[model samples]
Target chain A: MLKVRVIPTLLWKNFGLVKGVGFDSWRRVGPVLPTIKVYNSREVDELILVDITASIEGHIPDHESVSDFSHECFVPLTVGGGIFNLSQITSLLRAGADKVSLNSALFENPGLVNDAAGQFGVQCVIVSIDAHRTERGSYTCFSHSGTRNTNREPLAWAKEMEDRGAGEILLTSVEHDGTMNGYDLELIERVASRVNIPVIASGGAGNYQDMIDAVTKAGAAAVAAASIFHFTEMTPLGAKDAMHEAGIPIRRRFEM
Target chain B: MKVALINYGMGNLGSVRRALEDLGANVIIAEHPLMLLDANRLVLPGVGSFGAGMERLRNGGWIEALYQQVIEHHKPILGICLGMQMLSGLSEENGLHEGLNFIPGKVLRLDKLGCSLRIPHVGWNEVNYREGMGLFNKIPQAMDFYFVHSYAVVVEDPADVSATTSYGTTVTSAISRHNIFGTQFHPEKSSKSGKQILKNFLDYTPC
Candidate 1:
């Protein structure tokens, strides 16, 4: 049976990891490698390492840095931020990244998904949509670390990404991010209901109940959070216990 | 024991190496098929389209070398994900493509299951493997492994199937034919249970 994954998102900044509020006011959390080691040992289903500034800086993911980080990371590592072409994806994979998450690059060149999935197989391409709830309550995608508005709707954009052969969708609520209030359950349900692909709900996971709500209420296949782990007393394993108790099919933890 | 991990310009070779190294196994990234001669076991780990994986393997002179190493010499080899699918008789991914034909089957798209479930069944799923088999001797029944694949091999022989997993349907998750073995899930990224699997593979001695 398919199990719900509890993924921990590591927002990468210049060198270390950071968590931002409303996609701004960044604060360094810790280094990259050690954090990955901590998560991997905790039996986290996957780790998403996004260099929040890569797209804004007009740069690609640091292959060498990712190589160093992935060596310590045993779980599936999805590296994002500033990826523009297939060559960069290839480099990230060669650096030990299991999947590459594309955002800003998709706004201009959605064909990259088709081509990347065509070559690397659909399982490797992840289209991360950062949705900022506008004043009208309609979700609009924000690109380049939520700085630029792509003017694309999350529902239609997620469907397009799925049509283009994305293996999974990482839907993040820019406003709800770092708030630890709760995942934008409605935003997640909107896209999850539209596409057949698995949707990983991100942002506003303050407690165990929040992760459970994302899966049970929002229909998210997986739940990802950063601040919940950084600020509170929540751990991935503890969240899994909560989700498992809530009747979600969670992966059985194994001993070495 | 040295294990030659075939790198035909497709697949995540680095992740596999780190995973194996964590298990205390010597892993060599084999770009050419010649490296298989020195290793005790062989690992064909890949991620890409069926046609492209075969094209790269053939162009890199891996097809003939792999055949000699696994079929002729009977070297224990394990294929992971796309590598496992390549063991099939054929694949109907984007086109009707030929595979290594090591195991009897064809790789077909999972979307044909006609279920509302997601395609490219990503994330962790349980694998129910046959007991007493060397490949899964250390793995418990219904243990979850990290899986991310759209195509699954339709095995010709039911006895060839070593493990099955539940998705929208009962799908073949692992196959074993004598000394040959393959898994649709990635063991390297599957954490503890996955590491135990790698260890079992290294110690497997098909009598």
Candidate 2:
């Protein structure tokens, strides 16, 4: 059986890794290289790096920067933010990223995702969905750094992304983001039930129990945390230990 | 200790570089033909279409020198993923594309099997050693390795197969003929088992 992955989400702003409460107020922690080194040392199964500022500057991820991470990253790494074409995907993968994620580009042109997956393998492609709840409590898809709203239903988009050859879906609920009030269980359950590929529940992780509940109840294939880890409130190893103690089957970093 | 990783301009060589360096080997990303001269061993890392990789190597003038060095010098040569597939003579994928022809048998698109099993077999699977190859001497037979590809090499002669793993049917996972060793999986991304496999190749004595 494939082991459940525990990932720490890192944000890249101006080529530096940062962590924040939701999307704003990002604090520069360290360079991406050292941050990856730290995560690799912890025996983390995987890492997710999103370039939060790439879209604003109209710049794609710097291949050399990604190469630095892949050169040192001991585990699988997924990078997202500002990838729009087949050439960009090729550049990202060639530079060492195991997977390149897209969100805005998917809505702009749907064919790119499938085309990329066809040329490369599906395992190298991922779709990130940023969803937020309306006043009526209906989940709506958001794009362009969550500034623009698409009328498409959240669950509907999840299925579409999977059908478009996304190996995994990075689903983040805007309403629950950084709240730590527990995941929007309804949103997670809705998407996870519909999609065949793994769904990583991102945003609003407060405690170890929340992570556990997200996987067990919400059916999230993986759980991503930022504030808790960035603030040192919970370390990746600590969360994994807590989960293991709670009877969740997770891979451990065995000392060689 | 300068290890030359052949840049055919097709596959994932960066991860392989890091993996080798972790084993204390100084790795050099060598794309030019002369770069191979300064290195001790050669690693041919490949991904994407096998034919394109061969064409790139040929156009770059590295292919001729690569064949000359690995064939005559008896230096360690590790072909990873598609690099492994390129070693064979022919492939059924994207029309009949000619390979390096080092290993016999035509590479066939796994989709032809028509099994419900997903193509580009992703994630981890085990490799069962059928032959007594010292490269995997102490390694368990069913140890899982990360795989991501759609086409597999089908040997005309089974003796060249070092190991086999099943996706729908048992397919060749590793093959070796003299100094040439090819792995269909990426050892760099494959955790501890992968590290050991790389170590075994580094320590193996060539005839």
- Whose lDDT is greatest here? 1
Cα lDDT tens digits, model 1, B19-99, are 888778888889777888999989998877889899998899999999999999999999999999999899998889999
Q: Which candidate has the highest TM-score of all?
A: 1
Q: Pull out the clashing pairs in model 1.
A: none
Q: Candidate 2 at A146: error in angstroms?
A: 2.6
Contacts from the true interface found in each model, as a fraction, amount to 0.81, 0.39
Task: Give the per-residue lDDT of model 1 (tens digit) for A82-167.
Answer: 99999999889888888999999999999999999987778789999999999998989999999999999999999999999998
List clashing residue pairs in candidate 2: B11-B47
TM-score of chain A of each: 0.99, 0.96
Writing each residue's lDDT as its tens digit, candidate 2 over A38-135 gives: 88777676789989777666778898989988878767788888888999888888888999889888888988889988877788888888898899
Chain B TM-score, all predictions listed: 0.97, 0.94
After superposition, the stretches of candidate 1 with alpha carbons farther than 4 Å from their true spots are B94-98, B111-116
lDDT of 1 at A111: 100
